[model samples]
Target: MDDQQNDAAGQAATRHAADRVLDAGALRALAHPLRVRIYDILSQYGPQTASTLAEHLGESSGSTSYHLRALARHALIQECADRGSGRERWWERPVGGVSFTRPAGARTPSERSATQLVMSEFFRHRQDRLLDFVMHSEEAEEDDWSKGAMVSTATARLTPEQLEELSGRIMAIIDETVDRHRDQKGERVRPVSIRADLFPLATLEESS
Candidate 1:
């Protein structure tokens, strides 16, 4: 089965852009790894119940329920109607997804702490995903499987404005491709993540 042809159910998951900027309160609430994991699963897989989420994440229902409530408190997620007559309440990412920024100057200790904690989680999550794939790539023991996973680096010289334009175009293409194939499904298809980073290396003068 072609990789993209599979994962129709995963592709069917609603795509929500991050429209809501997180305030300090929301940032603090999202700083926990478990909370972030919960949010990621819900956002990627669509609506989920605490019990179901707990099962997937290997946590207790009570623990998952607590984190779900905390996320809901900041409106990162909202309650949805139950599936059938089930007692478990389903929750989903808010209509628009969530976002964050470092706090402004004159920050309180709590504000600084929250931002640091949240950013740490962000880096950890990204690195962990790549590391996990690397550790398991050989286990797949297939050319296609190994080739399917990869990392690439490219460098270019350009003015700030030109760089921004280039980045925008590249990102647009990626987004379009992902969206076009978002809902495809096949037995061999599986979920994959695409991450991109573009930044200018610091010049000696700038460093000084």
Candidate 2:
């Protein structure tokens, strides 16, 4: 198959894989720095061979190959059909996106740690991107930028119940907006990421 066809197939496979909510173990598997970097590359550039990734990351092809296998085992990625060469295998992320959902009645320390690790990596990635964008803003056009770019951290006086209610409202707004654009079609309409993060900073007493 041609490269374009291969890329389209790989994207379809990845979107299909992302449709499922990952389990705790799967989240942990995806939390590794190398694995996350691999996903970021695939999301930006489509399917890639382990050798290509190794070259990009300055790591050995064997090491990249191993991490690719681990991601596949966790269902985060899958092997695409190899090009004409039998030795060069390509990999793609399975899902268009990943969401972490905690199971009810969770009590295990290991499970909690897994969740924390995934979240920490996610925030770290976000912070890095924000810093990069700010550092490069001189080269980016201001007219093309959205005014919704701002980061703020503050302590709010709210009970747990109030916080949950606020979170639900925020999620509803996000869902409504997403649903409105779900069927949009145009040359300008491409998949854009919208990340909304809401979490408690600390207990009321601890913050004070």
Candidate 3:
């Protein structure tokens, strides 16, 4: 995959982007663990074909192809018209954030189930990535990355309004930084995962 082309596509996609909130159908479509993995790979690594995905996933090309088509039917993934030839199709995830948060309404049991599954798989994947990096950091961490890296945790108490405000501020900073550097390419440049997680922990009473 060409990094520059991928970044250019990402820049264009972000320029016209609105966060995609998964509907019940899309939620169900992505509830499978393999599908979630496929989606995550494209998001993190850029465009790929079914064969390439299978190579990364340790699954058969036929199996990956089937899931890829299922995802495409829901417009969660699309064929790269500029990249594929004949039966060899290249697929890429459309850039921008995808929210699993349901809108204000009553959701069916199936929808709720789908939501849980999707969220579970997505978070599990994130956890695996974090663990992988930590496990190999001794060998993989270059001087620059090690110096630039941060891994810390802090706890704070705040009201819902305060928390919301803080979250908005954090996201604004992230968005600005990403927008400014989304298209950056250089000999030393690399893809970095920037994660932000902000949520209220359960009170002692609630836990009990």
Candidate 4:
């Protein structure tokens, strides 16, 4: 399939084979805004040392190091044993989809708050990235990529069951494509973000 089609399909499939639903403790660990940012960086840019992450985040290495350790405590991230050494250990987000949905029986106020914080931070990060891309897409458009790059939105009405079935099929195609090219690397290969937002719109009465 083409890049645009593939990206649209992949984004539609938010849950995947690598998805991991967060438990209460993991949600709490990831609730902090700084930790969420750190996790996002690792997810997007691959492995990095505390120093590099701090530099990119405009925070002190010490501050980033503390958050990294906290994240590691809950296994949200882990050491890259093959890279870095000593105090400058490399850290990476384990390859998986982190589902922020609270686990069953985790309805305590604290757990709910944690889940909200993490989800908010996660969406904020995604929005910021998308905005950044929009601001810079003109530069990219000058190249061959413009043909496949697009920004689009649409609305539809569907029953709950239909939505579930549609999303499942989208994800199945995405999974097959991703599994085949998960490790692709070459001179022309670059990381691309796939984004699709499929959710119910608030009704007029609900908005009021």
Candidate 5:
């Protein structure tokens, strides 16, 4: 099968494979705004030291190190085998990426509460990232990346199952695109942050 056909055939199976589950502790650990920012930086920039992350985020190295250790304790990140020594440790996410949903095997309302915190942070980070691009994209666009930077919004009426399928398909398409350029030799290949927001309008907020 060609790449397109392969993606179509494996879409159902591959979507879940790319995302690992988070437990209550892990969810809570990542709910902080700074922790979320640190995770995003590491995921996008590859392995990073606490010092580098601190510099990028304008945080103190001590603060970054504390958060990095917390993320590691929950297995959200790990030490890089090929980089760093002594105090300048490096960190990266696991080979399998993580997804934000209800915690796996959560039994209590308290566990679900952690999920809420994580969900809140998720929305905050998503908005901040889009805002960053919008606020400063003029300088970046001069380098020929403007076409890829955009906010796409669409509304649709569908059942929850349909929404789930749509989410899977969107992620599958993204996976296919990333895998295509992941290993090939290229000069201008740059990281592109993509976000998808799909939901019905009627229930955008919780009922009182």
Candidate 6:
């Protein structure tokens, strides 16, 4: 087998071995903004000390350490054996990926509110990062950059069934593409954010 095939197979194996579901408590624990940020950092850079995480997030060491412990409590992350002096602890995300889902039991009003708050904060954080990138691109060449730009919005005439099928296809395409390129490594290539958003159009009556 080729190098690409070997890498793909290895990733598939790792993904299969990883946990695919998060309990409500685990999801709630991971929903915190600081914890999410720390997870993203660790996923990109591997294990890191709390001090290092604090420096990267511009947070106090105490605050970062607290959040790290909360994440550990939920099994979202774990202490790594490789680092830390006598007192400090280094950590890494334990699972290959985290999947969020509504639990089996009906959610209480408070639980529903908590879930909404968590999702809202997560998306707001993502939107802020996208806005920051656009705002900071003043020095970038317009013509050169325009070639790499994309802005697409469409309103399709389709039944609900068709819409559902389309959504599933789109998600599958995204998953495949992300999995394909996830393990590529080189000095010239670095991490790039690829965000996808999909939702049904709101009716005029609903808007009014």
- Strongest candidate by lDDT: 3
The alpha-carbon deviation from the true structure for residue 92 of candidate 2, after best TM-score superposition, in angstroms, is: 1.2
Q: lDDT per prediction? A: 0.74, 0.69, 0.82, 0.80, 0.77, 0.70
Task: Work out how many backbone clashes candidate 3 has.
Answer: 0
Question: Residue 92 deviation, candidate 1, in Å?
Answer: 2.3
Candidate 5 per-residue C-alpha lDDT over 6-93 given as tens digits, one digit per residue, 9 for 90 to 100 = 4664674565675777867888798788998888777766788889998988989999999999999999999999888996798997
**TM-score for each predicted model, relative to the true structure:** 0.76, 0.61, 0.84, 0.83, 0.78, 0.72
**Residues 56-149, candidate 1, lDDT per residue (tens digit)?**
9999999999999999998888888545245678898854445566545416778777777777777787788888888887888686867877
Model 2: CA > 4 A from native: 1-19, 82-85, 102-107, 141-193, 199-206
CA shift at 62, candidate 6, in angstroms? 2.7
Candidate 3 local lDDT, 1-208, one digit each (tens): 2565445545544543577878888888888999999999988777899999999999999999999999998989999989989889999988677776642332888888888888888889999988887887888567787668777778999899777556655666677688788768889888788898888999899999
**Tens digits of lDDT, candidate 6, 12-41:** 545544646666687678767788788777
Top TM-score hit: 3
What ranges in model 5 sit over 4 Å off? 1-14, 102-106, 137-143, 159-162, 182-187, 203-208
Model 1: CA > 4 A from native: 1-18, 82-86, 95-97, 103-107, 141-143, 204-208
How much lDDT does candidate 1 score? 0.74
Which stretches in model 3 have alpha-carbon errors above 4 Å?
A: 1-18, 102-106, 140-142
Candidate 4 lDDT by residue in tens digits, 1-208: 5676656555656556457878789888888999999998888778989899989999999999999999999999999979887867999988666675643346788998888788788889898978988898888777766667778987779989767656765666656666677678889777677665667778999999
Cα RMSD of all models vs. native, in order, equals 7.3, 10.2, 7.3, 4.7, 3.9, 5.9
Error of 4 at 204 (Å): 2.5
Ranking by lDDT: 3, 4, 5, 1, 6, 2
Instruction: TM-score for candidate 1, please give it.
Output: 0.76
Q: Of the pair 4 and 6, which is ahead by TM-score?
A: 4
- RMSD of candidate 4 to the truth, in angstroms, is 4.7
**Candidate 1 vs 5: which has more TM-score:** 5
